[model samples]
Target: MKSKLSWFSVPYVIWMAIVVVVPILIMAVYSVTTAEGALTGENFVGMGDYAGVFLRSFRLAIIATLVCLLIGYPVSYWMAKEGLRFQRVAMALIMLPMWMNFLLRTYSWMSILENHGLLNQFFQKVGIIGLYNSLTGQSIEYFTMLRTPGAVVLGMVYNYLPFMILPIYSVILKLDVSLLEAAQDLGASGAQVFRKVILPLSLPGVLSGVTMVFVPSVSTFAISRLLGGGTQMMLGDLIEQQFLGGAYNPHLGAAISMVMMVIVVVCMAVMNHFGEGEEQAVML
Candidate 1:
């Protein structure tokens, strides 16, 4: 009973091999080998020079991912459990921002957060800024909000929050409502039900959200550039420089890309391991 559609994926598989696998292979080869094609460990060693950049990028990304999780879980749970009509609208609203270009969203944040921007102006007009200065006994007119790691994290969170929400929402939607009802029947509190049942069952979504948010946050150049400003650099910025900066070196860029790819693989494996742990928790 072979269906005609059984082989439908062959073209996609071939396209993926050509468009994705081939370039990665070329980059991997270029990374470890010198101009003379002699393999060396120096490329890996070179990673040390940008260690601070890596640390800062990961630190901010971890914070942003956690923040998204903290904010997204409740929202997703609420929305996923809503009436079908409202849920459809809520889903649409959540996806509305994504329909716009990502760069435009980041740029909008820049305008809002900049000094004398909408945020500051609104606070001032509302007298919140004056009250803050009076309470703190400081004569400061405006506080610096833009061009910092916090700003970078904010941009990452804003851009990737949907990624965290959507996966968790879908997972929650598919969850067996009976398990929740059974836990309730056992006299478990709302939080207890979530802890012992809902959360564990939603592990797949949580893992997906973390991967979706963290990977892009760790590797993002635009958010760091437009928000963190020129003063900060993520691995993406560093890699871009290696390739396109005045001192262009394709080999170094390729090496950095390879290292970044390894890190991504490790993070994904760690996330998967957490999903397994959650499965065990559910069984218990």
Candidate 2:
């Protein structure tokens, strides 16, 4: 009966093979096989694309993940403990921006950060300095804010915040209130209870949130292009350029994509290890 019912899944399985597995297989082949007039081992270059991504995208991803964790943890905790009304309001607010186009959100930051923009205007109004400072002159100092590495991080944090919050919120909502009460009853200070009990118990959510934020942020191209300009190219942008830009080198793009996949896989594995440890401790 189970075996017979499995036949119903055959279409879905074929779809997965066609859409997911086939693409991945093609990427893997492309990553190893170089462009040639004919298929040959001469085109196969080993580990170069992976090494380039590690040198470029890895640091940005690490920074973005850390920023998301720092910002998301406290917000998730507050929502979880503050009752359903507040939780609903907060979650709605977090998710509201997602309804707006992501590219529009990225571009909006440019309006505020551009040299003649709101931030500079606000500063000027407050008599901090003129908009045309000696360093920036009359020209918009997009490099200072819009095109900097900081912009990339800011864009990533903005884009991926909801991903981090939702998973962490789930973990926090399910936390055993009795454990918190027990810690308080045992003369644990508020800080001590949080550090020892709340933090440890929330590991699974934290891991899930980190994985969600890190993977997408690392692979996002629109954020980097819109916010960081040409200077702040991430691995995603590089892959995109190879595929869509005049370069038109899908082979190199695939190689870079594979590198990104490996990095995400490794980071998730490390987070999962710690998450499982916390779960086991809770069980014991």
Candidate 3:
């Protein structure tokens, strides 16, 4: 029976080998070897050149993940407690925008945030711009959010919010109501019950959500590029430059990827410690 089940997995195993394993092996080869194909440790040494990019990526990813958690947790918790109909409506409201392509959505923000964009025009027409201009004694065309790290963080939070929400929501949905009632019987107030029971039980979901958001946010290129105006180069931008941009250095790109992979693995390990191996349903 085991052998029969093993045969059924052949297709998926082959697919992983072709798509996942092959690319990883290729990256590993390039990560250690120079252009002339000589085996060397130079690639690892070169990573030092991009240290700032690595730091920026992690910083922005952490910021975005924390913001998502702060915003998403209460909303998800509320939804988890709501009636089924309200929950569906609220979830739909949160997710409807995600139906569109993420690139398209980000590009749309450019029109709203750019200098001389609709937002600026609205402020100008509403007289707020005039009031500010008079107070500052200067003419301002727009409030520009583009080309800023904060804008990049906002974009990341927008795109990845759903990933953070779903995991926590799933965990909350399955929370045992009896535990809450028991805590209440033991003289626990709402705050005490939440602190002692609800919050502790929700740790697994929170950890899963953080891992989901942070990994993608750290590795994302599109949001950083478009919102950050190609100026705020994070780790993803550095890797893209090596592989696809003017640099055209696959070896360097592979080295960056390896370092990033290691960082991600370390972060996951730390989160798993918090979770106590309690992660459920969320994909890594």
Candidate 4:
């Protein structure tokens, strides 16, 4: 049985070597080489010129992750405490949008957030835009929501919010009911019980959700490109431009990708370190 299992694993190992390990090795080589195939350090050295882009990417990602957590945690907690049928219906509703094509979903937001889009039209009809203009003494016809940093953040939050909710919902749903009952019996107030018991226990899910949302949000190009109208460039967009766009600089692209990967790893490591302490508290 062991030998057969090992034989089965051989195919997976080969696949990883081809698709994962090989690409990483290629990227590493590209990052350290010039267009002429000569060794160079200029690729990494030039990253300093785009410090603002890196900071903007991280800021938007962090904002999106926090927004997802702020919205998802309560929703998850509510779902966990609901009846089975209700939970199923709610989950179905939550996941329904995801069934659509990712690009289509983003395109829909483009229509809604554009200057003359549905949201603006609705607000115009309702006199909100005019009212704001009147109060502020401005002549703006429509709110400039698209092609901005906020639009990119909104896109990230909309797309990745589910990733934040599902893990937290799963974790909160599986928490031991007896723990809540025991805490209540021991004269803990509702808020106290939640703070001392539920919140601490839910840290792992929060960490997982943060990772899921932040990783993609930080590296996303499609959302930034579509919604930002090329105004809000991110690390992923920078890398994509290098490899595929008119920039045509694979070495620099690889260097940017490598640095982004390292930052993500470091962030996750810090989060996991904090999570360890939270887990210890829960255990105690």
Q: What are the TM-scores, per candidate, against the unseen true structure? A: 0.92, 0.86, 0.93, 0.95
- What is candidate 1's lDDT per residue for 141-194, written digit by digit as tens? 666788988899999999999999999999899887888999999999999999
lDDT of 4 at 143: 94
Question: Cα miss at 200, model 1 (Å)?
Answer: 0.7
Error of 1 at 97 (Å): 0.7
The number of the candidate with the highest lDDT is: 4
Estimate, for each residue in 138-231, the C-alpha lDDT of model 2 and write its tens digit.
5443335778788888888988989999988888888888999999999999999999899988887888788888888878788878877877
The digit string of per-residue lDDT tens for model 4 on 138-198 reads 9889999999999999999999999999989998998899999999999999999999999
Q: Where does the lowest 10-residue lDDT sum fall in candidate 2?
A: 37-46
Quote the positional error of residue 99 for candidate 2 in Å: 0.7
**lDDT, candidates in the order shown:** 0.89, 0.81, 0.89, 0.95
Which order, best to worst by TM-score?
4, 3, 1, 2
- lDDT of candidate 4 vs native? 0.95
**Model 1 misplacement above 4 A:** 1-6, 277-284
Q: Candidate 3: which pairs clash?
A: none
All models, RMSD in angstroms = 2.5, 3.5, 2.5, 1.9
Clashes of 2: 0
Which candidate number has the best TM-score? 4
lDDT by residue for model 3 over 142-258, one digit each (tens)? 777788998899999999999899889988888889989999999999999999888878888888899999999999998899999988888888889899999899998998899
Superposed model 4: Cα runs more than 4 Å off: 1-7, 277-284
